[model samples]
Target chain A: MDPVFMGQVLVRLLPPLGLTMLVSLTALAIATPLGLALGALRAELSDKHPASRIIDAWVFFVRGTPILIQIFAIYFLLPKLGLQPPLFVMGVGALVLNSAGYQIEIGRAAVQSVPRGQWEAAAALGFDRHATLREFILPQAARRMVGPVMNELSQLIKASSVLSVITLFELHKAAEAISSANLRFSEVIVVEGFLYFVFIFGISLIASALERRLSAAGALAGAGSFAR
Target chain B: MTLLAARGLVKRFGSFTALDGVDLDLNRGERLVICGPSGSGKSTLIRCINRLEEPDAGTVVVEGIPTTDRQALRRKVGMVFQQFNLFPNLTARENIAVAPRKLLGLSRAEADARAEALLARVQLAGHADKLPSGLSGGQQQRVAIARALAMEPVLMLFDEPTSALDPEMIREVLDVMVELGQGGMSMIVVTHEMGFARRAADRIAFMDQGRIVAMAPPQQFFDAPPHPRLVRFLDNILGH
Candidate 1:
């Protein structure tokens, strides 16, 4: 209700926004390739393969449990086992592990969604398995993956708020601290909410724009006559 | 003179037999048309030659090299599918160009030039930049032919290439194929288009229940089909 007070809270939220960005972006950078690799392996290997089973179990565990428990385990449990990482590392690592789980499914669905004919076409053209995947399969699959990947990214950015529990000075922590000090819970919380909305909404916009561009370029290459 | 030989090919999917004790041969520059009732293994036989479906028991030798030499088979054999199977993301030209550039190691410019020439051959030069979705069924099939031709294989296998086309679109694709046959590209086409079989085939093989019921020159095969099953099949297909 108080515009001036809200303005003050917004300025305070800005500095920690960088840390929030760093944690999420860093997690994404690490998780994207890792998830892609794991997802690709899971998709490529039969369910009977040992590595596939391990990856399936890993994904199952990460997805089934609360992410907060995952963070607590990494932060509190890992150190108890005589291995201590920095607080920031623990927080980012938890986000990386959590996001990568979702990303694995994203990557697998993208790869599997590519038509079987594409693989056969590549093979009939004499492409080895590796070249077939790299040149034909992945290029087509990647277009389909954009929307899911961006959605995962948005979820990751929001999930970074949980890092505040580990005492990392990200945006949510800043909001909490300012609210406690100023005794202005409504004003601070509302500004914090607005900032998160803008950030996540911006990502969604970028995701849609990217989806449009890629689909225009490829135009649902996996969906048309070839799928038959 | 024999470019390909498959002896005693037996392919089974679970308990159902797709190809059973099939034997086939292709002399250099020969055009062979295979027609059969659905599920009679017409598609499966050609697919085996290309190693798309590994035979449960048999051998496929192309140009004296066995199918185990996958690279040689890849280089020496090209296949067109029933679905056209053009890479949807790539333009018509790129679809034709990719195999040559990647497998044959042609530089981009060289590959593009080859694609352009092939597009012209298939009578699709003007539509090079268009995606498969933008093209008609006939145009896409032509592009598919061009894509297979880009490999410059001595042998081409077409697995019902026009089966999925609209009736009007079938002729344009068949024309391109007939032109390829005239150019002496050894081919094994699995199609129900008896018109194409008559015009382009040197030998027509009739199959039923995964075995070739009859094999003869097109004139004799049509006029005097050797097997009772083939007689019933031809009557069923052409009786209307």
Candidate 2:
């Protein structure tokens, strides 16, 4: 493969890649809050309660199956219900559905990591379980779950590549167009892969750096305070 | 008039009976120390006073409010823990200010000023913005005490305030507590520190199983120890 051809292909691929990242980041913003709320609802709420089982069943259905299939269902099924959500919405919907499944697991683990006594203590202090989870547990849980969430976000960046199959013209789509035009499929794939690598790698660096800073800020002021 | 009252406080955790049938009373400005074996339910009994652990069967009334309304009970009573359950994400100041800001509807500046004063009282003025993670265990516990003080609570609960601290750090934390006691804070302290109990507590209550076996003025409880178990338990803790 010619280096010049590869560079040119990458140039075409960058915009789509950039857009994909934008979409993924936006999707990530929504996924974190929604996923965590759903996750909290599961643990703090009981299966015996009417809503708990329903939430469990939803999580089960989402997690039990594959993302690609869910995307196809959302893309195909919703229009039948007379709602033609935009392509961006579909892409976001796909990303949200897929990421939420993973996030549900992440969120559940984070909520559980909080000691039972914390809630008990809060309850004793006069905060109801609901208020306690909101004010105390969730904030601490969010701090603990940051690394996993970054990992999920990195995965989301990669998973978004799947969207190209639906013809949304994300970074991968640009690569495909360049490939089809140049008749240099191998070079184009390499270019796109590198782009994905850069995007994911850059995000990973930022996330870890932010994590360090947050931990530092959170550490107790003096003497044997453990950083998060 | 009783500030807090628990009647036939029976608490069970699954098959294990943590508290069998404990009953107690507390009054305004009274400092009470609860001491017993690890499973003796002293912690549970005090915890129940604020409805921390709801008794399977029994009624707990705090400041004329049924313990069933935990939120209302909590407004009247504040608890500091051995674990120093300060909010990790929040700064030392934020931890102190949370209940006041949320429960009392104090503005941020008001809460901060109040928190600042409480932190100063605990001798942690310089570390106000620091998170619980950066503070020493003793320091964190002090912050917890400061947090409770932020509520200006009618009654306070200290569940082994010094137990989780280092030996050298114990006195530092206890010093602050002793000061609170002197200031006439109504307190229920669950601790093994007999010396502290003797110095600060107006009354001493000793528990075994789930019941208080002895309750009297510290001088009487320590000197006479009518219950055989308290005599042994006190001997064991002091020995340890």
Candidate 3:
């Protein structure tokens, strides 16, 4: 467990860090709009609407199941159905599904948090449904969703570590490889834990800063006089 | 000629009727005040005018257009709320400019210019950059009025616009509203501000039990209230 040897091993793990970043970022990119749409359907639409009911069931199914099992299902089950996506795609897909479930709740709560008066005022001022959501509703809801969505983003990054179980050489897998080769289990574990902490902590800082910015903009509050 | 009319506007909340066969007419440049005790359909009638609360039954026509024609009706009818429903995320200028920019397709510059002028009209020239949270209740309501005026609506609906303000702040909002009335904006105002009704309203419509119990010129309505319920309400509100 020489310090210099540990540094080399950590550096070797950097490639997997890149893989983690790619998978998580891509998952977030795909999940964001999909989540917003699902969230809007849940919040703004009636329970009787088909999409609303579908979202309700989708959310329950995704949230109720464990993320690890979801990844396994996507990795192992899809191939049986003749959809043999690459392991990377399956991993990202699972992350996207899991992240979108959480994001849908965040987006729904944020969107619903906007006062109903905003919609009424927009309508009274001649804005249609899409215009109201685009111009007035989303901007405000986005401000409120910043902290929560960022929290979810950080979670996705950590969750990507689970992708190694599916043969993806993400951070944990790369570290495990190094530890097994060198027999310095404690040092590799500690170093990998530190890396995860750094990544999640960086995300946490960005989220708080964004939260501050949104609060300072008073963007959400400007929509109405509702006290947070 | 009527610029806005509601014929047989009806609304219900479960078992409670909020509005029943409500009929009202607004001519261009007319200021009409609505007054009633809480839950008397005063707010409901004005809300139906803009389709904010869809009437359970009946037709609302604005300048020969039905409420079913939502965009047409909305563009022509602007509304202010009791709680000053200013877009809380926007500054006074943006709140006033958003509709015109988005709906009227005004260029950003043009909309901002219009917002500036309307803010001046509401005597809020110094507060254009302030968000609703930064402003007082009175200032926010004035900004709300300015936001409505920015639409250049053919008719304005004020639903208890001053009811949420403090006694001291009520005058400032009322003053802006009075100025709008003098400027010849057609208005349907729901308020218990009898003085405002006295000074600005050409007609006063009193509601009770989800119906207009009396409708007359302000002076006639004040001097000789037709309904005993209205007389009692006026006495209770104005006696102080």
Candidate 4:
């Protein structure tokens, strides 16, 4: 439990923070637009809109199955199918699918939470479907989704630890290597835990600030009838 | 010329019928008030005209265009709602400008200028930059009216616009509606305000059980209602 040894582990872990962020943020970047598209399509779901079945199935398959097996399928099985993506791409691919599955639900709830009157108003004003959703609905929904989506991003950050199974040396992989090599399991693990906490705590802080700004920007009617 | 005409309109919710073979017509620059008890389908009829609620049967023609042509129809007709469904993310000005810019291809400055003029018409000139959430209920409803008017719609539909406002606030929204009605804009309003009907409505239609049972000038209808349901409804609305 030497202080110098802990400091060395810290330095080692710090470099991989970039790699960890690279994976999670890239996965998030891919997932967000995909999730928003799926969520928008699903929001209009009804018996008449049969395409939602495909979206529903995709969401179910990704959410119902385990992420570990998904990574394994992409890394191991996909090579047999003549689609051997690099290990980093494989890890990112798996994380994006998993993150987007949850994000679909988050985005759908946020979009639907906008009052029905907004859609009606948009329609009455001659906004086409795309303009209605893009200009009117999505802006409001995006504000509501900010906090929940940040929480989802934090979850993705933690979930990136699972990527080590595919040999991608992200934060947790770096910590495992440092701890086992130095025989400082407790110290390295605790420090690694602290690092993860910092990432999530940072995101939580951003989410709260954004929420406050949004509430102030859209403060309910002077009489406060817009409480919801 | 007719501004709007709905013929044989029918709407149903599962087993219950909301609108049953109803027919309505609006002349250009006319103001018609639709009054009914809950579930009488007055709101449904207005919604169908804008295609907000698709009718199970029949056609709504606005300015000779069928409701099936939703974009064309909507461009000609605007609607205000009970809940004042103003976009929460945009300022009052943006809410009024967005549709014009996106749909009508107005430049930002043009749209903003139009929004300012419309806000002034609705008595919301100073609150242009404020969000609808920060406006009072009456102010929000007035902003809703301005947002609809921003489309330059040939006709307007109001579905209980003041039903959600406080008693004191109701007067402000009603004043805006009265002003718009006198400005020669064609409008169909669903309301229980007998005073608004008497003052602003050229014709009053009383509905019950998904049917328009009576249509007459407000003075004639209020003076001696033709139907027992209308009499009872008037008594209930005017009693207190």
Q: TM-score winner among the candidates?
A: 1
| Model 3 score (lDDT) | 0.86
Best by DockQ: 3
Instruction: For residues B160-217, write the lDDT of model 2, one tens digit per residue.
Output: 8898889999998999999998998888999988899999999988888777788889
Off by over 4 Å in 3: A1-5, A218-228
> How does chain A of candidate 2 score by TM-score against the true chain A?
0.90
**Candidate 3 CAPRI category:** medium
Model 3 chain B worst lDDT window (10 residues) = B60-69
Q: Which residue pairs show collisions in model 3?
A: A219-B89, A221-B88, A222-B87, A222-B88, A222-B89, A223-B87, A223-B88, A223-B89, A224-B88
Clashing pairs in 4: A220-B133, A221-B133, A222-B134
How far in Å is the alpha carbon of B41 misplaced in model 4?
A: 1.0
After superposition, the stretches of candidate 2 with alpha carbons farther than 4 Å from their true spots are: A75-88, A173-183, A219-228, B66-68, B238-240
Categorize the docking of model 4. Answer: acceptable
What DockQ does predicted model 4 obtain?
A: 0.49
Q: Which one wins by TM-score: 2 or 3?
A: 3
The CAPRI category of model 2 is: acceptable
Weakest 10 consecutive residues of candidate 4 chain B by summed lDDT: B60-69
Tell me the lDDT of model 2 at A11: 70
- In model 1, what is the error at residue B205, expressed in angstroms? 0.7
Q: CA lDDT of each candidate? A: 0.88, 0.82, 0.86, 0.85
